[model samples]
Target: MTDELRTTMERVGERFNLGEYEIDAYLAVLEHGELTASEIAAETDIPQPRVYDTVRSLSDRGLVELRESRPMKIVAVDPGDAFGDIRSSLAEMVDELEARYTAPARDTEAVSLVKSRSTILRYLEEIVADAEYELALSLTPDLLRRFRDSLEERVAAGVSVELLVTPASRAPSPEEFDYESVATEARARRGITTPVIAVADGEYSIYATQDALRDDRDRYGVIFNRSALGFLVSGFYGTVLWTTAETLATDGESRPFPRTYASIRRAVKDVHELSGEFHVEVRGRDVATGNEIHLEGPVLAHEFDASEQVASFSVAGEDGDPVSVGGLVAALEDVEAQEIVLDRS
Candidate 1:
């Protein structure tokens, strides 16, 4: 009832892991002691069924006790103690789930596409919680409209949802919409800040997007959850699209990236892989010293900071895979190179 008491309960509730609903129940019962289940529900605006459970929870932990008679009335115990017990129980459950997921698996490969509703939810939930630094999302409007509530709940619980909704996606009548403002209320203090987005999350990344113009309703979603490989791909290409939004200066061209943010969406058949021509430098003594082999045309760019008279060359390869030592020697020899000087510093 008093400011001092509310702040105390909030800190206590945090310790015990009480959500807003639980906190409301505690405070309302504190003000009006000895109330029936229905009365508490009405006063607190919690569902009648949930109110009974909540009160029962309080009673179990000595926060509330039922008067030992007919038409049983409930009394508030030392609100803090009752709420603390609730916190400990919840914490144990989360600890269990974390342990369950952290165990090593035989299938070390990352998941490509997840389709089932329950599994998809679990996947998203894992991605949301597993995010150590940031979580990026390019949500189809339809998908967001469907699971909007579930997504908002994550935001409420201290998960920073840096969302990416396309220009074409429209809100659901403005009333069913508004993830930012409501989330700000419950999560702002807990570190859930929004309107921040990038497909890359430092070590691991996922590219989730849909073409609204071609398909208004997204049939399925894709998730790339690999760590090392995903990071390499994200480093090269993810920022290009993310840059379209983040780098836009007020006076500068609104679209900072050369093409629309969807440029990669068109070219990228497998959105998980980074496909492009990336420069690679070679270094070794005697350019023609290595075994002569067929050269990959136009793909390699040779840079000799100091030319043992080193020459430029191109090679064909994926970003994540490492270059073979022998392959480089042969490629150099195929170009009929002389005096190879490796750029290795």
Candidate 2:
């Protein structure tokens, strides 16, 4: 063989080998079906003295079977069967490693600059998935499509999602896309100049230039980790973008059954949006009894304060008496519909 060809073969062998001579010996047996140690060393470039050790190593790794014949032959295991246990071991290792691993603490800096499009998209997806209570996003039509699954998952998990897509003409029309499955409310901004923005639970936020989506190489985004900094992004979204945007779609019937509300106003608003009389299940601690209460009744009236974060709602039981209950929104854990009978009988 040419010197160049020998070097190339050695490089190829190195990749598949557990150690020197192992891959060469395994390949020799695989091609020849069964080979004695001396035959393996002769078929490949392995040294005669190391052939037994190489084949023994292959045997121990289950890549080849060893037979104690007069010449002690090495037999190659089928590639699929040989690697099945290794594949399973690798998968198990990954699971155990992930379970035992602890992620490093994030840097406490309030603001960070990210310059890669892939990285920016990754953080955007993470922000959406991490949201607990609410999410607000301003996305290019492309980004809206890219994050459709992530947004749908969060909404299905009971996080309130409000989405804006720009420029209005480029966005999918309500008939073309199922926005109600992903976002509680969706709108289309009139201009292309609207920057991509996202705020999660009013705590984490990201703002990026349109170029971030238009040019992968020229991508950039700003991340705000602190709530104080996040508010600036949220403020810009609420005051400038949200007010001027035209509603594309709204899903009043798709609202999540309220659970662990942070804002009483939002909770009350959700309850009010329900179509007709619905049975309510309120789960909380009874202040007087110091015991857990699971109350079910028809809601009579509901009131809430956005500023004070307090809510009072009444429910009527079978005896036709209304019981008034009031609490801080944070303390009200869950209010779910027990039944939604179409008929008012």
Rate residue 317 of model 2 by lDDT: 46
| Worst lDDT 10-window in candidate 2 | 336-345
**Best-performing candidate as measured by lDDT:** 2
Number of the predicted model whose TM-score against the real structure is largest: 2
lDDT of 2 by residue, 1-345 (tens): 446445544543443458657877888899999999889878989999999888888887788999999989888899898877556655555566577688744446789998888777877888898898688899999889999999989888877787999999999999999999889889999987798999886678899988886774457899999765776787678658876889888875655444434223444556665556545555555555546556667767776543323455667644667755543222343332211211121
lDDT of 1 by residue, 1-345 (tens): 446445555555555565566667777878887787777787887987787677666665466787766666877777566556657656655565566565545135564653445444455555555553234554445545644665566555443344544443243333455656322211111111112122323333444323312333443444555543454434334343333432111111111122111111211211122234433222322335544333222223333322112223444434533333221123433332211222111
Candidate 1 lDDT for residue 64: 72
Clash totals, every prediction: 20, 0
Off by over 4 Å in 2: 1-104, 216-218, 257-345
lDDT, model 1: 0.42
Q: Model 2 compared with the native: what TM-score?
A: 0.50
Models 1 onward score TM values of 0.33, 0.50
Q: List the residue pairs that clash in candidate 2.
A: none
